[model samples]
Target: MNYRKATEKDLTAIVKMMADDVLGKKKEKFQSPLPIEYVKAFQNINEDKNQELIVLENEKLEVIGTLQISYIQYISYLGGMRAQIENVFIRADQRGLGIGKKVFKWAINRAKEKNAHLVQLTSNKERPRSIKFYENLGFKATHEGMKLHF
Candidate 1:
């Protein structure tokens, strides 16, 4: 297995992984399948220095996991920055193989590389295993995650 930052060419596979994540849990905010155009948007994230999408691939170069991290500059903390993790997913068959953890570790390092003051993520209550996994990786559940659906 290997890991690398995603390129535009990898969008289709990444979108599939994202879909898997949405389907694997109940109470997730995802409401429908992602269109290929949605992945195209992520592909353009490279234009922003603070945005990144990464993928984990098997020996055959097939993407099996993905994660996106965004960094935002903040004035409240004296110009410090925060890194937010979104859309973390590992292929269903790839679970329990440590691929997810490796992806997260890479994300954390990438955040630090960007000089972020903190790295954060939120998981739904229905995903207890995901919450535990984040906690095991030194992420603290310090805030309530609230969302207003349209």
Candidate 2:
């Protein structure tokens, strides 16, 4: 599998993969031309120095997985840099192939290369299996993650 920065051409496939799951099905609007909002969001992320949108492809060059990493600089932890991983999705057909672990390892190493003090991610509480998978990856539930959706 090849992992690299995503391009505009890969957006459709990326959105499709993200929408395959239950949670994503409710949140993503995956369509043939894709909504302009997604394009705008991609452009914003691409322009940000701290944002990285990545895609994993097979030998055939098919985009099969994707994730976004955001490097946040804050005054906390003595002004440390934190790498936040989000929107991780492996194609449904590609699940159970250890690809998720490999992608995460790559992301973590990338964070280390960027000198991030730590890497973090939050999975929906409804997805117990995903939480367990994260636990296997050495992530701890040290703090409760809360969010207020508008």
lDDT of 2 by residue, 47-122 (tens): 9999999999999998989999999999999999999999999999999999999999999999999999999999
What TM-score does prediction 2 earn? 0.97
For candidate 1, the TM-score is 0.84
Candidate 2 Cα errors over 4 Å, as ranges: none
Candidate 1 residues 100-125, lDDT tens each?
Answer: 88888888888898899899888889
**On a 0 to 100 scale, what is the lDDT of residue 148 in model 1?**
97
- Full-model lDDT for every candidate: 0.80, 0.95
Q: What are the TM-scores, per candidate, against the unseen true structure?
A: 0.84, 0.97
How far is 59's C-alpha from truth in model 1 (Å)? 2.3
> In order, what is each prediction's RMSD in angstroms?
3.3, 0.8
